[model samples]
Target chain A: MISARRAILVSARTLQRTKPLRFADPKKIRLREPIVPTHKNFDVSPDHPLWAFFRDGNKTETVLRSKDDLSTDSRPWDMPELRLKSFDDLHRLWYLNALERNRISTEAEVAKEIYNGDVSLFTKLDDNHLMTQKRIKQTLLERQVAYERAQLSSPEEYLQLFEDKYINADESAIAEYNEKLVRLQYAIFGIEPDLSEYNLEEDINVKFVEGLSYVAKLKLGRYLASNPGALELPLNGVMEELPFLVRDPEVAVEEVRAMREEGVSRKLDNIEVFAFLRNAIEAVRSEPEELAEEEN
Target chain B: MKSTSFKCTCIISQHSPGHVLACTSCSRICSLIQFHLFQIDSHLKFPNTNEINQNLKHTIPFYLTAEQSFSWLIQSTLSKCHVTSLLLFFSKLQTSLRPISITSTMSFKTAAKRGQFDLDRYVGNLRVKTYKEFAKHSRLPTIPAPIPTLRKDERLIGEAPIVAGDLAYIVSGKHKGKISRVLLYTRDNDTVLLNEVTKNVVIPKQYWAANQTSHVLEYPVPIPRKFVRLAAKEKDEKGNVSYVVAEDLVFKEKYYDDRLKRWVPRRFVKHHENIEIPWPSPMSEPKDDQYSTLTEDVYNKTHELQTVAKSPFPKSVLNELRNPYSKFKKRELTEGQARRLNAPQMPLSVEQKIYLAKKAQTPVKKLEPLSEEAKDLIGSRMAEHLAKIKNPLLLKHLEAVSQKTTPEFQRVLNEIEGKQD
Candidate 1:
């Protein structure tokens, strides 16, 4: 029912943007449009585009599986092979996968509650979804590489390659590359490259950590959250999801600017920290003698 | 009565003062009639008059006159014997104006046995409740959602979910009696990865052959810490001493054994008892929630703001790059670094490539490792050069030119010279 309403809302928005269809006879027009039952109602008019959906016939199946019922073949739809020809196609596919992943996770949480905290059903669902997403990303990365390679033969190859190397690489890679690049320039001028002041290995490690696989990144994030002083990543948001790796500082600057527009106006007053502090003080005051004696 | 002086028969008094006798030693002045009455009631033999006088002389309060002492003695004796006088004195004891304080003899008993001062009473009122508990109970009480509570024995086995690196006893399998260490904790998959520490058993036809194998079970139960007892070291015939773990030892702490329906050693508790090993206090629990611990202030401050997305290049990388030789010298360089260094030097440009093609290149000298001081000097000069070049393109060009080794450069020079000849 919710999906039907959403579909209707989307169609309604599209209808609003364009002209209304003119009927030959005014009497033929109906007052109310037929409602689409998105969640459960599979039976629909044969002429409808979704008629193929009812081809399998009515069968009871939940949108999300419970933890115990999770299996490899539990996904609602199989991800198609990646033969993305263009950037737009890749982008669209990425968006679609992200959308599905979000929906599955959200519905899985609700399903967990409905099943009374038994999340075994969602276990296989997440595994399958993550695998599919990984495949999609691998396809997208291939497409991006191919596109960049194709661009190299173009008239602006130098400029394109320059952007590819500096902008496309992650921030830490760019920094390391930049330092090395500078040293190279000095060498070209017959001057020695200065690198002794910097710890190149540490820099590379930080960059390597930044470039860790998504699963590794999540694991690292969890580890850092539990134990903050784990591997020190370059970014302050070590616990957050991967940030855009663009060479253009202006892009990052603009993003920061946009974020600041929606940022909090007031400083957070941590009542809990203060509350803890106050409690500690009161405890000390109440049992100063005993505490002192214990210390002695 | 005055003519015939009644002899004082009071034990406390030696002589009588007229018809109303004042016993100087007794600290009581009483009528001769009262003194005569006391002598008749008290059956205990009295000391001689002289001995009584000596004791009374020391016992009497200085503030009391001989008459008062004689009267006090008569009153004390009467209160003990006469019901009317005793009732009067008891009534006075109830009032605030009573001459004496009646203290109960309860100080001799231990506090635990003392009825009013039981330790349990105060301690019972002193709860271990925290603010969270106070808040939980203070709210409007609602019917809690009922959850199925498993019995101890039923709960003992896989009651508490097993984690990685836990120890377990295989209750049902090809290796039924084997003790194993948990490897992978896949709660979703009813099977866990385990390495058997005990003697090896033949692989069942249905299972794969290996010392370590993933076994499917009805959720393998974790061996409770209480069941794991420290065993004494034993010497084998070969004179090798080894520590053996004793699982049969009764747990010192009494635990309710559901199957037995009685308090028993914790080891006797059901194999499925859902007992969790008490974890040491976590420095901080991993919290994805915004309201976690001392950092809540920072979390709240950023709550409205989107969390900074992770950056591929963090400033820490730059800091590392700034001091590559220090801190992590033992660590291997990342593959990315090796790739970047080996990347075919970016072509300087179409023009530079053409220009290099026309020139007769000079042979470079054999490379030598720089001394520490020389490296420092070179590093300082490079820092100055880096500071001056803001153009990324120029830096790329440098990277391209610096890719070749001395041998590679020498070959290139030889090729150019051969072309010139």
Candidate 2:
């Protein structure tokens, strides 16, 4: 009644039991095999060696060291002369602060959940730890600011620094953009635009195209046919049809320039491979003398 | 034994040699055979007699005798020696062995101190010898040599009058805020020994430095005679709070003493003989006695007599300006008093509304011809307006009415009748 695979397995097991493979120096020889690498890639990615220290899943259940010994202190250590610390020192402090912040937030969440969200319990349970962590974070931030200020050589540099640190899209503008994106998604999928209690996966249904315009509906239908099981519309084609949803030309141009500078190759649409090769060859041949000099 | 089986290490040609291990087919000789033999010889012992005898049986030719075969075997075994010479010749053939072609390896000479001095040859006993040990000393002076003190007359070398008690302000240098009294004067280097005059304590001889330019100068301000307030306050309507100076409520009058090239009180002259300047006002006033003395009475009488010739200042200003001590004392107003004087005002009474009404009625009075010049201006303006009337509708109506009433209408009718006839 046994299959060939089962028979082979049984015979192999019997053979192994009858005569085990013996090493010349069994005591000296390592019993364990060489460690199998967790990562297959050498370059930067989720599977890279750089991410080896991180957990496999989003839920971080790994608690290092003694959690019971944690205690609260009213006064936190103050580093008023943090600005005097070297770049390496500041970098270390910043990393430590970040680690502490992550630990505190996780701990606080766990504690809150355990106590049924009774926040007053936090006072008894290492509350000062969070406060001290924040203080340390602030100290590190101040040190960074001071260091940056010291490094700045001119008003232009200061302006650039300020832009790098503080400048971002306005909150209201981001909210409006998000709303517009949601609306576009609704229109494309032919779902009723209800932001009050919306869940993208559950709410989006291709069958409900009654609210969508003819062109949008057609685009959605084609996209669905081409890319089955996709929840969102194909952005490029959809954006062309919806002019208002398209990003600013200047911003798009800036993004393109940034990408080009970062060495991202542009997709050569409608051009033959041979023509592309020829153009690349011509460009390489006609490269500027400074680049040639740099090579030398 | 496997002489015929020898293969060339070259991958392209698998040539077997006829006698010597040279590839006739490929027209090439592999020098690797010599290296192979050498490697085998170095790793294992050199092939002994038995191995040689065995090789001879297989490899020797049939025409050769035993001696000849033995010699041939020996030659074959030592064929490497001849091959090496051949290799050397071939290598020489490929590359010219000329002096110019032969290159020597480049080497560098490092710069370093390589010699050591022979101390024994130079001198013996390098250690220094001293009989007196500093640590073994029994007595040590607690203080260094006594400081030399300069004579008073020896210090008075300047033409300008210098006194010991003269106070000087540090006009410049790091010790700027310091005010000191001259303890001793030295005119040789224009230096002075000074004692710092701090509150209730005189730190004697704190410095004895030369009086460089702008270092120390006479405190060039006289003691003020009377205090005066700088800012004036206007009286409020209630009259309960009178006007007072807001800033520097009590200020003293300071004067410069040109002769001493310093500032001092009027009492400074009292120290000098043959000077008859009397101390004035509060300087001579008895501290506890509020009653005016005979000298005060005389001073007041003279002041009053002098005022009779000229208009006197108001009593309020005179009283307030007289005493600086009292003025300073009065600056500390109670919280209630301060609030009453400076708190936000209540809305003005109806009796105070006359000004607002007058302000509102400004246009009425403003438009009125209050003066003869104004009336004349209005009259001229009216005449100018009347003169500017051209092509009026009323004039056109009047002209039409006159035309209807005129004889021209009848003439025109008669002319029409004549034409018909």
Candidate 3:
């Protein structure tokens, strides 16, 4: 009676003994089954034989008609439903097919006979093959024209254009543009934009939004007002209780002023700020009656 | 008196026969008669007999006969005649026989009397008077003049005057060779302090870079030369002895065991020993010549190797044998043994376990499920594949044939999906 471990070892030894001594030729092998079904409903019997024949015949006729017509039609044959997807996906598929064909033939044959020498024809066929592709290119061109017109019309846009063109046009341009956008957003809102405002991932954005909302609640402000000597404590305590609120000087100053008006002016000392914030937050969180009693 | 001065004639015979006398008198008989008359006259003249006899009463009498008396009377008349002459004779004889006394008792007695006299009081009074006279003359008592006080700058004058040695302290340099004995004040320039005890030590003011005086080197005794040699020997002997002694007592006196008493040795001791060989013969070699005799020799050389050879089992066999007690050392497993060990056990998810069990039971060939559609599609493609495979021109077409049928291709796809999962 052999154990499982002994059996496995015996099998391994048998496999080693029976294995082939020479490597097999990969090119000589052939598959009896289909490689990958293109569609979930793929069948052996041709459902559109007449359409396939017309397409094949048209491709040949187009080749004889004009080199440009053949090249235009040489793009990957898209399924009718594929036109509804993004232009980028259609273009990716087209390039993938072209690469596959090129692997079978030389690049020269594909470029000369398939893509045709005319760049316009290639572009037109790709645009016609996918309606989304034509729409995207038109929108891009229109956006460029409109941007140019806007740059010419306003001094600010003109300045931005000048900076992009002469000052930081090459590698730093996008970074500079993003910095300016953030600055403009900060100026308009008087606060940094929350991560969710940019439609970031739910977990990350939610955490960021929650953190920002915690900052905006002025929980630290209320704590500072309630605790008279908390601001005099070390930064560690103040930072731990209300990490987000302590970072902003305006919020801190406003909170200090609120505490002062409430006759708890002594809490404004920087060292005691955390203790004050904690007390203020506690006061704000307590029941209304308790808070009123504390106020008194 | 000149009426008749009788010349005394006398036959005067002196005792000493060496004298002869010629008297200036009358003729011989007359001279004789004169001598007799002088004697009688001299006798009468010597003083009245009765009166002389009366005066000599305290003296002893001298008796003479009538003849001798008549002769005396005649001699007396002659003596009277030449008294000066007789007198001269008597004087000469007296001068010649006179006795001289050398010692004078009167002078010694006079000196004694003088010594016995009371002169001390007079002498003492004279001394007082002399002293008074001196005092009166000088107007002061005679005392040794107070050692004339020396001025601050004045040096006492005398032959080989005793000048104090320099008073000095080591100020700035090493040793500064501080000395108090100012040996020589040469040329009134510099003073040298002789460290006589130290010998060859002559320190000058320049040495100390200061001028000081009033110190003296007292109790200066030279160091004995023998002391230096004794010190050096002591140090050398002590050093060697110290090295041989215990570390803590290296600098202290040490004692060694003697016959009857503990005594420190003056020199180092050396010891030697003779080694004895127990086994003298070389070892015997093995019969097999392929092996070196040295290995066999070593095996026979040691008692350990001999003991090892006496054991029943070979060394390798002994090592390979498992200990019988090890079976009792097996650990018993507790419930939830995997949690205690922190080892991952077989996954317990029902679906995962079932799938794994199924995989374990299925045959490799039947692992992939066959769909009806896939089957139908494959059936149709089989004809095409067969046609393509037979045609030589279809070699190119065969190249397009996908590798779906190969187990390796399916395995690669499955691996990719597995990684993604």
Model 1 residue B51 lDDT? 32
Candidate 1 chain B, poorest ten consecutive residues by summed lDDT: B100-109
Deviating ranges (above 4 Å) for candidate 1 = A1-69, A72-113, A117-124, A146-296, B1-220, B223-421
Interface RMSD of every candidate?
Answer: 48.0, 42.9, 96.3
DockQ for every prediction shown: 0.01, 0.00, 0.00
lDDT of 3 by residue, B331-413 (tens): 86556664788866665898988998999998775344557999899989977777657667677566577533677766766
Clashes of 3: 51
Model 3 C-alpha lDDT per residue in residues A1-296, reported as the tens digit of each score: 44423433344443343333342353554323322211112222234222222223212221112342334323323233342333344345445444433222212212333333323433344344354343433433343344345434434454345334433334446456446534443332222443223312222222333333333333343344445455543323332334333335345645654654676444235555534544544444455778689999
B28-65 per-residue lDDT for model 1 (tens digits):
32221221112212222223344333333233111223
Model 2: lDDT to the true structure: 0.34
Candidate 2 versus truth, CA RMSD in Å, comes to 46.3
At residue B303, what lDDT does model 3 achieve? 16
Which window of 10 residues has the lowest lDDT sum in candidate 2 chain A?
A35-44
- For model 2, the docking class works out as incorrect
